[model samples]
Target: MTDGQLQQLVSQISLHDFKRPFRHRAYFNARLRTTGGRYQLESHNIDINPKMLTDFDEKTLVGVIKHELCHYHLHLTQRGYQHRDADFKRLLAQVGGSRYAPTPKKQTRLAYRYTYQCQRCGLVYHRKRRLDTQRYTCGRCRGPIKPV
Candidate 1:
């Protein structure tokens, strides 16, 4: 959705759930990696991960919005707004907001540290860490494992 749409949704959710208005901006932030949304302490703006929409459904989106709104409204009202705060927890439960943002899929690639070949069957093996070739053997043909 567009930024305007996001702003509207946040406003609606704030009014509907919290009975308060969300005057600050809410926008999709592509730079957000893992968390579904974040409430800025200084700017008071809410940043939502664009990937949330692509990966999840409307219910999930609403939950995330409500979660951020909890932070927003509490902070504005001079209440406990942090996750560890009792006021934040109570408000979150009342609004049925998600406790924690869903984690995004990890994109880091792992490199193979060792390569082994079966002495008799010629089967290749890949591993993330070095393995003892003397102890481990090929499962298919019971052949000795040799470093390749």
Candidate 2:
């Protein structure tokens, strides 16, 4: 959704759930990694990871928005806004906000390309780069290593 749409949704959620108005901007931030949303302490703006909609659904988006709103309102009101704070925890649970954002899927392939095994001990190891099997031995049993 567009930033304007997000702003509207955030405002609506704030009014419905927190009974407060979200005055700052709310937008999708493509650069946000891992986190589903973030509440900026200085700017008081809310940023949402667009992946929340692409990877999940509307319910997830709402949960994340609620989570960030908890931070936004608490911080603006000068209450305990940090995650560990009692007020934050109580408000988050009361609002049923998500405790953590879903982990984002990696867009790029993993770098690991090689696997090595100890011939004698059957110990396995993974490496991103080619291993010098001749030079490296299994520390477990001093056995020769071979690429599998």
Please report, in order, the local distance difference test score of every candidate based on alpha carbons: 0.91, 0.92
TM-scores for all candidates: the values are 0.71, 0.73
The model with the greatest lDDT is 2
User: Which one is best on TM-score?
Assistant: 2
Cα RMSDs of all predictions?
6.2, 6.5
* 1-148: candidate 2 lDDT, tens digit per residue: 8888888999999999999888889999999987899899889989999999899989999999999999999998899999999999999999999988888776997668898999999999989999888888998999999989
Model 1, runs deviating above 4 Å: 107-148
lDDT of 2 at 120: 97
- Checking candidate 2 for backbone clashes, the offending pairs are none
Candidate 1, overall lDDT? 0.91
**Ten contiguous residues with the weakest lDDT in model 1:** 101-110
lDDT tens string, model 1, 92-136?
999999998777666677688788999898999999988888888
lDDT of 2 at 84: 93
Question: Candidate 2 — which residues are off by over 4 angstroms?
Answer: 110-148
